[model samples]
Target: MISTVLQAVGLFVATNIDDIIVISLFFARGAGQRHLTAKITAGQYFGFAGILAVAVLIALGAGAFLPVEAIPYFGLVPLVLGLRAAWSSWREYRDNDGDDDSDGDSATGKGSGNAVGVLGVAGVTFANGGDNIGVYVPVFVNISHTAIAAYCVVFLILVGALVYIARFVATRRSIAEILEQWESVLFPLVLITLGVVILVSGGAFGL
Candidate 1:
């Protein structure tokens, strides 16, 4: 039991450590908006729940549900999201030229950009997690249902912890300033790059 618990912790952290930067970037754009923070958190949970569901299904003999090679197609989710974000950023600049009170959709002139709200966050989270699906399927194999439940519980708890830690980093004054300044550029670029990498690295490109 202890071993299972430890393994769950180790596996989850190892697989999900990279999410810190993404989650932090999301929080950085919150700009003290508590509602936005709640949205981000809920979106994250929603996205991860989808991932877990897929993994569990595939592990439980639902192989036909999604062929292994098709996982790369998930990259499309983030790729499109990135493109959408980029478009919003560009439009914001073109229309308002960074004016804070120009009556743009975001009065702040520095909101996280359009299309990057709850569903957008959730979509990208699900998209960027292609690898987690690959790792989780095999890990769930042959394990007792009890251990699986333990793993899931531990994983969800740690996900909340991950969000809190990233939020702390994002809320730091210095980091927040930089993120706010470049969020328009950085967020889309990061998302696009992540998508391309996932597609290419999966060893089978295209739908």
Candidate 2:
């Protein structure tokens, strides 16, 4: 039981660490909007839930993570999202003369999050979840449903804890200041890099 629990915790962390950067950036962008924060939080939960659901389905079918070639397709989700974010930021800077960040760095990533709302973030989470499905299937296959339930509970509780930590990091004045200056450039780049890595690693386009 303890071993199973440990495996669950390890699996969740291994699969989810990449999401921390994306999720934290979202929280940072909307730090001032309590309402938006709630929505993003829920979006994270919904997105992860969707990933788990897929893993369950595939595991029950006794299959692997996905077809090898199809793995690269998941990369497109973040690629598109990153491109959308870059476009939005560029437009905001052009429209506002690049000096209108009194709201929360719209020229950075705030508007993208707002415009995409919960669904967009959820989409990113789901698409970025290829590794999650990959790691989850083996365990889900071997475990009983009751154990699966426990694993789910542990994974979810840790997710909430992760959110709390990342959100707290977002609220720090030092981090916030740096993010305002650099997130406009770095955030989209990170998403793009994530997508590219996923694509290349999955052997997309014969790369």
Candidate 3:
């Protein structure tokens, strides 16, 4: 039981380290907009739950019909997403001529008075979590359903805690400033690195 609990903690942290940055940005958006914090939190959890559901399904499938080794190929989803993010950032920078306001506008979706919609945030979370499926499938396949259930419980609890942490960091002026400044560049890089890590760890590269 203790081991399963520890495993759950480790998996959550490993899969979600980048989420800290994403969550912080959402909370920062909330700070700028009116009463968006709760929405962002709900969206984030909704998105995370989606990722978990997909991973669990894939894991279950892997036990029967799917080949375990093929799991690493899923990393390509995040790799492409990361590359697209980078390309978009480059295009935005070039188009805006490096204007800070433009960056703010893009990050915060300025046209909208309210925070991002629940589905919008969920989409971001799901895209960002593409690599998570690769990591989670094996972990889930190796364990019993009972352990998986425990992990789910722990993950659901931690998702809320993570939002609180992100909100706390977002409320801080300096940290929020830094996130806004670098998130466009940093987010893609994190996704790219995660994809590479998944591929390498899973031996998908045949290395």
TM of each candidate vs. truth? 0.89, 0.84, 0.65
Ten contiguous residues with the weakest lDDT in model 2: 107-116
Clashes of each: 0, 0, 0
C-alpha displacement of 35 in model 1, angstroms?
1.2
lDDT (0 to 1) per candidate: 0.79, 0.74, 0.71
Q: Please report the candidate that would top lDDT against the real structure.
A: 1
The better candidate by TM-score, 1 or 3, is: 1
Error of 1 at 77 (Å): 1.1
Q: Which portions of model 2 miss their true places by more than 4 Å? A: 62-69, 99-116
Tell me how candidate 2 scores on lDDT. 0.74
Over 103-197, each residue of candidate 1 has an lDDT whose tens digit, in order, gives: 63465545445433778778878877789988998889879778778888888888788888888888889988888888778777888988888
Question: Which regions of candidate 1 fall more than 4 Å away from where they truly are?
Answer: 32-34, 98-107, 111-115, 204-207
Two-way lDDT contest, 1 vs 2, winner: 1
TM-score, cand. 1:
0.89
Query: What's model 2's lDDT at 31?
Result: 54
